[model samples]
Target chain A: MDRLVESTRELLWERGYVGTSPRAIQQRAGAGQGSMYHHFSGKPELALAAITRTAAELRAEAERQFAAPGTAVERITAYLRRERDVLRGCPIGRLTQDPDVMADPALRRPVEETFTWLRTRLAAVLTEGRDRGELDAALDPSATASTIVAVLQGGYVLARAQNSPAAFTEAVDGALGLLSTASRTPRSG
Target chain B: MDRLVESTRELLWERGYVGTSPRAIQQRAGAGQGSMYHHFSGKPELALAAITRTAAELRAEAERQFAAPGTAVERITAYLRRERDVLRGCPIGRLTQDPDVMADPALRRPVEETFTWLRTRLAAVLTEGRDRGELDAALDPSATASTIVAVLQGGYVLARAQNSPAAFTEAVDGALGLLSTASRTPRSG
Candidate 1:
């Protein structure tokens, strides 16, 4: 059962929801057809389990950066600079491109909740920074948070489009640069 | 032949390369299988034609904003603020998520070229802005251009995830605000 769900996650990441099939999942998991059916009702159920797990993992990973010791900018910088599979793209963000995944609310909930949580969490960090006078008074925490999240998501798009991580790195650097301008503390070279 | 290519473009946008099928393309185009084969070798040929056309259209649309009379900030603002089908996502950017599309060099060429062109064009505009002393000396045109492009691409992902355009709008507004800080002339309310 674990292998089946794990294989579904891998296939979904590689081929998306519509392209992933029960046969493929079973084959990849080394589970027989009967074993697969015994585990889940169908592909949708299996996919939901996989997606849910992936979303949880993403949040846990991000929380580590957000909860780490740092100022708002430093925390965000850490998150942005953190190592990522730039080429494979964001597991949750990539699902937005899948018609099958987006059309189903059950499958889409995790994706939606994940972004909402990220934006809200980032905003809180920025708000804390502002209260501490670390960020400019003019910075809108929520809006800035969205931009920060968007950069990562969009960076993946650029990287995948060019088949190189260069674009993604440049985007992160550019975002960090712009974000620094919003810092109340004058950055030193 | 025209109808076939147009239909393929629409299907590719709606369903992506992997999900779209030749039969669906023919049916949507009102062209028979024979007609499809007559004009193109197969799905790959038809898809290339469609993607090529889509890439061209995207460039033309973006060029209008980039070419309009405006300051560097205003031009970038115009490009970012231009009314878009926020829910549908970017025609060209969306293709980056299609694994099959990315795997094929011929298919991926237009996607790569479009972004390279967009980044170069945006960098040129930023360079002009910096040269005119409209932007800060510290700005890196190439990297900043990638961030701008990434925001749009990432904004689409956000909007689609929430099934609302609000995230996309917020991202743009946030980006514009961050960009304003880099302006030499103080922004007026």
Candidate 2:
């Protein structure tokens, strides 16, 4: 059962929802068709489990950076500069490109909730920074939070498009630089 | 011939390379399988033509904003705020998520080149701004350019995830606000 879900997640990431098949998942998991059917009603159920797990994993990983000891900018920097599988792209964000995944509410909920949570969490950090006078008074937390999230998502898109991580790195550096301009104190990383 | 290419482009945008079949393209274009084969070798050939055309159209549209009369920030604002089909995502950038599109060098070239051109073009504008003293001396044109491009691409991802254009607008507004910090002269839009 575990293997089947894991295989579904991997296949979904690599081939997307439309392209992934039950046979392929079963083959990858080293399970028979009967085992897969017994575990889940069908591919949709299996995919939901996989997607939900993937979304949870993404949030936990991001929390590691957000909860780290740092100023708002520093925390964001850690999150942005954290090591990533640039070529493979964001496991959850990549699903936005999958037509079948986006069309299904059950499948799309986890993806949407993850981003909403991220934006809200990042905004709270920024709000804290502003209260502490760490960031410029002019900075808007929610909007800035959206931009920060967008940069990371967009960086993955650019990196995958070029088949290299250079673009992603450059985008991050650029965003970090712009963010620093909004900082009240002179801080170096 | 034009109809076939146009149909392929629309199918590729709607369904991606893997999901789009030649028969579907032919049916959509009102062309028979024989007619499709007569004009192109196969799906790959037809897809290349479609992708290439899409890339060209994207560049042309971006160029319209880039060439418009404005300061660096204004021009970028125009480009970012330019009306877009937020739900549909970017035609060229979306291809990056298609494993088949990224795996093939011939198919991926146009997508890669489009981004390279955008970054270079945007950098040139930023450099011009710095030279004219419209922007701060500390600004890095190349990195800033990458961030701008990333925001737009990332905005699409966010908008699609939530099935709303609000995230995209917020991201653009956030980026524009951050950019104002780098500007030498006070400007309002």
Candidate 3:
């Protein structure tokens, strides 16, 4: 049972909800029909568990970077610098592109929750910075938080399309540059 | 035959390359296997036609906005303001998420060519602005061009994940704000 769920997670990350097949999961997990069926009703039930697990793990890792002691700038920079396979699409973003996953609310909830938590976490960091006068007071924390998350997700898409990690690096650097600009007060000199 | 190809183009845009299947295309196109195979070799061939067709159209639409008569900033601002269904994801970005598509150069060429052409096209416009003294000579045309593409691609990911268009808007606004700053010469009191 444990192995079946674990294997689904790996396959989900690699193949997405639509591309993955029940046969693939059964084969990868080394489980037969009886074993998989005993643990769950079917593929959808198994996938739900896998998505929930991945979402939790992703959020925990992101929280570590955001919770680090620093102003919003350092924490976000740290999050971006956290080494990633730039050419690989984000697991969560990849799921959104999966027509099957997006169509089924059962499968979509975990994905929605994961990103929701991430945006909130990122927004908190931005809010803290704004309150401390470390970020421009006019900066909308929620909107800015959404943008940060979008840039990283979008960066992966661009990098993969170009077949070069340079695209990802340039995009991230550009985003971080925006952060630096916000930290500096604009006053008529 | 033409109807099948057109159906495929619409399917690719909505469901992505991998998410789409021959059965779906045929079903949507109201064509049978014999009709489809007579028109193209197989799924990949049909997909290639659809993808290439889409890439050409996307480029034409983008060029229309970028090449409009105006200062570079005005043109780019219009390009960004162009109405888009952000949560649906870019047709090209959807291709990037497909591992099968990325692994095959023949399938990948149209996508690659589209973005490359887009970046260069945008750069030329920016360069023109620089030469005309509409934009600061200090601007790096290539970097800014990549930034523009990244923000739109990334904005789609954000919008899709959050299930809100606000994130896409925020990211676009943020990137535009940066471009606006870049266009302005350094302030002197």
Candidate 4:
């Protein structure tokens, strides 16, 4: 069961839901058809488990930064700088491109919940920064959070498109610079 | 030949490179197998033509904004505000998530070139803004261009993940706000 779920996670990350097949999962997991069937009802059930697990892991990883002691920019910078495979892209964000995954309610639920949680959590942190005057009060927490999340996900897309991590790094630097500049200078009318 | 390539483009946008099949393209185009075969050797060849067309169209669309009379911020805002199927994601950006698309250099080249062209064009416009004293001369054109591109791509990912266009709009607003702030206020030491 564990092997089956782990294989699904890796496959989903690498090829997305549509490209991942039960047969491929089984072959990669080294589990028999019967054993795979015994563990889960079918591919969707197995994939749900994999996606749920991935979402949980993503939240936990993000929480580490959010909970860390720092100004808003520092935590976000840490979150952005956290080691990532720029070319491979975000495991959860990558699934958004898969029509099959997005089409299924059960499969889509975890994805929606995960991003919603991420955005909200980031917003909460930014709000804290605003309360403490670490961020410009003019900056909307929710909007800035959404942009931060977008920059990270979009950075992956640009990096993959260019077949280089430099694009990703440059984007992070630019966004962080913007936030840092805004934090100190505030917006001038 | 036109029908075949157009069909391939539509399928690729909807289902990605891996999910799109020659038979599906042929069916959608109402072209017979002999016609598809005569026009292209196989799926890869047809997809190349389609991707190339999409890249060309994207560049042309961007040029419309870049060529317009405006400050750098105005041009980028125009580019971002241009109507998009925010929920469907960028036609070219979506291909980055496909394992098959990324694996093939022929397929990947157009994607790479398109983004590279976009970044360079945006950077050039920003450089002009600096020269014209409309933007902070301290800003890195290449890095800022990457962030703009990333926000668009990331906006798509966030919107798709949340199953809404609100996230996309919010992200765009946030990035644009940052650029606007930067444009008006030179970085303070």
Candidate 5:
């Protein structure tokens, strides 16, 4: 990973899109202004690179969960069960809260694409489970996929608001319960 | 609403709790430094007033939808259907995204209270329906209430990420559908 990309990621995590500045990124990266500008046109260009790189990593991480050898239920449950710092919120979802990021199409494109790709990928995984008879054939894979994503994102919001991770866990648990309950082939109570 | 309080609310909305400054508020409110200090000791007082006022309005809005004359399904559905600037996100939920707001108990009190109050109020309405045979007695009203709120907050995150309202509506529709499906008490299919 390039130093500039790493610096942008750090700035993004700390100051957010609105608060971050190009000069700050250059200083953080240990690169002079010319060196920074040589690699990217400006802050938007640098931000796009950082956001896309983050998006790729997110996909790869999710793929690890999706590709795990287990029942569809086992895999998805494992995916949701990944260790996360619930208090910090999702880096991608956190950008949604920043007005500047949302206002800029260049920045928003990667964020939008990431979630869109995630939902599609998740739905595909669910579809395969339904096909293999691991999940209920009656389940709406796409809808369930959206619900899964919503629970995670919404859990962050609830947890952040309360300044406790309890709400995040509850929401996740509730969504998982829904999936199991709604499963055509119930495993066990 | 005093000039200072009004200014505080507007600034909180635009700059958020962390980004807003006393100097900016005074400038926007067209008040002198001494006059601003005279009305409120500092940012904390002004912010508390602003947050409290915002919470009250948010509750009133929810009550308007939840307390409307209709079946329980109708009322819940109405609440979900209420028009919103999905892109802008909920004013209360917006506070949750602010690090400073969540860190300070003084700042977080209204936000915490707002969601707590919303969940309680929603649960009460749900419980009423359970008693009246409009909903399943087996339903966990409080948990379901929390999930509904989560969906709205998450919808805002999705919408902002996409730079469009589509994801927000999809999330809302998905949650509302869950509510409909969960209703053991029959509604027209």
Candidate 6:
């Protein structure tokens, strides 16, 4: 049963909701149709489960970075520099490209919640940094956090488009360079 | 024939490659099977045409901003702030999420070329800016151009995930803010 969900997640990451069918999931999970149906009602149900799990795992992975000991810039940089499969794109972020997932409220919820949670979490970290004088006082934590998150998601898109990680690396470096300058400046965060 | 190509592009935007079937394109284009078949041999051929046309349109649209009179910072900001179908996502960027599109060189070429052209065009403008003393001499044009492109694509993903344009707006603002600070600073850009 757990393997079913895991397999579905992998499929969803690679193929998306429209491309991921129940038969594929069953085949990947090594489960019969009877067993698959017995476990979940249908594709959507199984996808919802898979998406929910992915969201949770993403949050947990981010928490590890956010909770690590460091100044706000250091923590944020660490989060940005956190290891990622640049070529594979993000599990949750990839769902935004899935038409069926975006069209279905039930399936979209977990994805929406995951990004919202990420932005909020990142913003909280920025706020702490600002309070601690690590970031410019005038910086908008929420906006900056959103930008950081966007750079990552967008970097994946660029990399995927080019079929190379060089563009992704450049985007990240450019963003970090800009942010580093902000931290050093005293005016207009 | 032009209508067929245009309709195919619209369906590709809404449904992606796998989801956009010949029947759907035919129906959307109001062309009979005979007409669609007469114009293009199959889905892949039609899709290639559609993607190529789309990539050209995107480049032309971007040229409007890049060619406008302004400082490098101003031009980049205008490009970022350009009007967009925020919720729908980038036509080319969205294709990166489609497996079938990414799998085929014929299909992927337009997408790859679009971004490559975009990054290159943007880099050229940045390089010119540095030469004109509108930007810091040390700024890496290629890196900054890639970053700018990333923000736009990433902004679309963030907006779609939240089902709101606010995050997208925040991200653009954040990127622009960072750029503005860099422009004002004495550091190597």
Candidate 5 per-residue C-alpha lDDT over A33-73 given as tens digits, one digit per residue, 9 for 90 to 100: 99988888988888888988988998899999999888777
C-alpha local distance difference test of each model: 0.92, 0.91, 0.81, 0.88, 0.81, 0.87
Pairs clashing within candidate 3: A154-B154
Local error of candidate 5 at residue A156 (angstroms): 0.9
All candidates: DockQ: 0.55, 0.55, 0.45, 0.54, 0.39, 0.52
Put down candidate 4 lDDT per residue, A44-101, tens digits, no spaces. 9999999999999999999999999988888998999999988877888878877789
Model 5 is docked with a DockQ of: 0.39
Question: lDDT tens digits, residues B93-153, model 6?
Answer: 9888788899998888899999999999999998888788877565778888888899899
TM-score between model 5 and native: 0.88
**Candidate 3 interface RMSD (Å):** 2.6
Report the lDDT tens digits of candidate 1 across residue range A1-189.
999999999999877787799999999999999999998999999999999999999999999999998899999999999999899789899889788999999999999999999999999999999899998888889999999999999999999999999999999999988887777755543
Better of 4 and 5 by lDDT: 4
Could you give candidate 3's per-residue lDDT for residues A104-139 as a string of tens digits? 888988888887788789889989998999886767
lDDT tens per residue, model 4, B57-135: 9999999999999888889899998989888779899888777898999999999999999999999998999888887
Q: Residue by residue across A1-189, what tens digits does model 6's lDDT show?
A: 999999998998777777798999999999999999998999999999999998999999999999999988888888888888999889889888777898899998998998889889998998998888887766788888888899999999999998998878999888777777667445443
Q: After best superposition, candidate 4 residue A133: deviation in angstroms? A: 2.0
Off by over 4 Å in 5: A69-73, A128-139, A185-189, B32-35, B69-71, B129-138, B185-189
Using DockQ as the measure, the top candidate is 2
- What TM-score quantifies how close candidate 4 is to the native fold? 0.90
- In candidate 6, how many Å is residue A20 off? 4.2
In model 6, how large is the Cα lDDT of residue A110? 93
**Pick by DockQ: 5 or 6, better one:** 6
Task: In model 1, state the lDDT of residue B35.
Answer: 90
- Per residue, candidate 3 scores C-alpha lDDT tens digits across B1-189 of 888989988887676666789999999999999988888888899889988888988988998998799989999989987999777768877788777788889988888888889879988998898898877566777767777788788788767766788778887776766566556556687
